[model samples]
Target: MSNNFKGGRGRRKERGPRTNDQIRIPECRLMSDEEQYGVVSIDKAREIAEELGVDLIEIAPTAKPPVVKLMDYGKFKYEQQKKAAEAKKKQAKVQLKEIQLRPNIEAHDLETKLKKAYKFLENGDKVKFVMQFRGREMAYKDMGKEKFESILAGVCEEASAAIESPIKMMGNRIITIVAPVKKK
Candidate 1:
């Protein structure tokens, strides 16, 4: 299916630049408050900001009209920080970890490797268990593949394959990825 398909239809038509939420002000904004330099003069604006005890934030520029607002700059900054912190807390951090093994791995070796992977998963990290083959080990590719699957099962409830197993032809490294279980 096409990636841009919308409800089985083609991509939607292009739209013009979206309107901004900021309220626009006339270029000669300062003149209304008490004429001076085009829009409200800088001096008068400063006076207004001081009177209202809020900042005269410039909201828009470059357009035929420019805009400014009277608001608490500190409060605005504080709210923005709050929103950012909330977004950060809502995000989930995923990390990748690696475990190496030799083709002639013994039962204890496998168990140790499995323990390391379990620790990684419990800590929210994915494990990429690599089975490196030496000279004769390459001839028995099935052994490595079988061992990889066995390791996957060993971490059963804690992890799952992130991608299809990848076998590298470089010298003799067989790599596979096992992703951590998503936290509930």
Candidate 2:
């Protein structure tokens, strides 16, 4: 086999913002932490960057004359990644949790299901209740609907949940969604 395979997964190039010699513009609006150099030739900018021991980074390539900044490119990249990670950590991820039910479920069993659903809602997750019907159980869809409605009411009242989707019948199942009410 050859060392290079056609269309194989190869080492990908870094596609980040242009820096140093990658900037092809003739002139740019230069800026730095200590002062703004206004407009200057690319060569002058590269010289200043070299004197300051930092990379000449093109921040706004679309701006008039294109804006460039003198800074440590590696440090800037690290800080950007750090901010992104912090944002992801603070973001709330809402997951959809499904709870299955049967028309003939006993009272205690239904209560157990509601407890689990409540736990999920309390943890910033959406709950989808599915009332499944099998064989002759389809005939008792009305009974299933009533039971589902009662379950929804109890959940909303006791768990501070709001009905996200009204109850609907889908083929062999009755479905509804509930989400925890946001606290002010």
Candidate 3:
């Protein structure tokens, strides 16, 4: 196989749209919020932009005549960045935090780990409870299942959380996921 097929690292950075004097096209389709001046010469577009104290930005370079817009490029760029940041901020990230335990866990130790799980649930994060068993301990899978169920119930009692995934035995370990309930 070719090296390029395996995620090549030589990709060039994408260039943004041309603005103002960078637009060398003889004519372009000019558009604005107030009005659109069909296909006009570059000089005419520049003249209009100069009169409005704005920039002539080439929006769709691939279109016939290359669609251009007359607007304050600085303000347009700022608004685009602000919108991107707001979208990023509104993105939901569901993180899964894990708590590991053995089938023969003590009561005090179970309480401590349960507190940690509750804290994770309260913070709107998913909690994965994993109980691992060794060779002989594998015989007591029921005890591990019962312990995990009880712990999940206790942690979800105060905080409104739901089981995201059901308990399943994976080799020597059993795992389950619990996520905080969504508020309307």
Candidate 4:
């Protein structure tokens, strides 16, 4: 029988700042909200942290003598997690919505597609108009390009959108991207 485990006790790898005995440096600049204790032996910093009933947290380990602070480790971790959650909540997520069209699509059908694109832009999403060409339709690429340009103009004017990517031909398709204009 062979033991494949390589490490002791299978403890989870810790993240963020090193606290208390985990800080192995000989000396560090100790600080707290009230005062700075300059550069002191690591043992001395630990003692002061004990006196203040706080943990000696190594915040900046790459500095000259390293930097440690006296604080409640649990509270510090909680605040950091809160800040991250708040930032994620405030971030804007934009989705890409594709609308397919054809070179010789009926006027009514084109209008319907444009309406869907307008709704997507109003909802803070990007619109990709893909005009597909098949067989003999490939010969009419110029007409497809013209239709894309006209669609782009109409969308920009009616939906407060801007062209993110100009119309371009890609193999058998003409593609263009439009995005909603940012408010304020």
Strongest candidate by TM-score: 2
Q: lDDT of all predictions, in order shown? A: 0.63, 0.92, 0.88, 0.91
**Colliding residue pairs in candidate 3:** none
Q: Where's the lowest-lDDT run of ten residues in candidate 2?
A: 5-14
Q: Write the per-residue lDDT of candidate 2 for residues 1-184, one digit (tens) a residue.
A: 8866656477456588899998999999999989999999999999999998999988899999999999999998998899999999999999999999999999899889988998999998999999999999998889888988988898999999999998999999999999999999
Q: Model 1, residue 40: displacement in angstroms?
A: 11
Q: Please report how far candidate 3 places residue 17 from its true position, in Å.
A: 2.5
Off by over 4 Å in 3: 1-13, 21-29, 33-35, 38-43, 60-67
Of candidates 4 and 2, the better by lDDT: 2
Q: Give, for candidate 1, the lowest lDDT window spanning 10 residues.
A: 15-24
Task: Residues 1-184, candidate 1: write the lDDT tens digits.
Answer: 6675567455456332212222234332432233333566545666766776666555444544454555666765687689999999999787778899887899997888788888887777777778788888889878877876666666764455344355454567777667654545
For model 3 the TM-score comes to: 0.77
3 against 4, candidate with superior TM-score: 4
Q: Compared with the true structure, what per-residue lDDT tens digits does model 3 show for residues 28-110?
A: 99999899899999999999999999999889999998999999998888888999999999998878999999999999998
True-vs-predicted CA distance for residue 170, candidate 4, Å: 1.7
**Residue pairs that clash (backbone atoms under 3 angstroms), model 1:** 30-39, 30-40
The regions of model 2 sitting more than 4 angstroms off are 1-14
TM-score of each: 0.61, 0.89, 0.77, 0.86
Clashes of each: 2, 0, 0, 0
| Candidate 4: tens digits of C-alpha lDDT, residues 1-184 | 6777768797667799899999998899999989999999999998999999999988888999899999999998998999999999999999999999998999999899988999999999999989899999988888778877887898899999998987888899888889999999
The positional error of residue 158 in candidate 4, measured at the CA in angstroms, is 1.7
TM-score of 2: 0.89
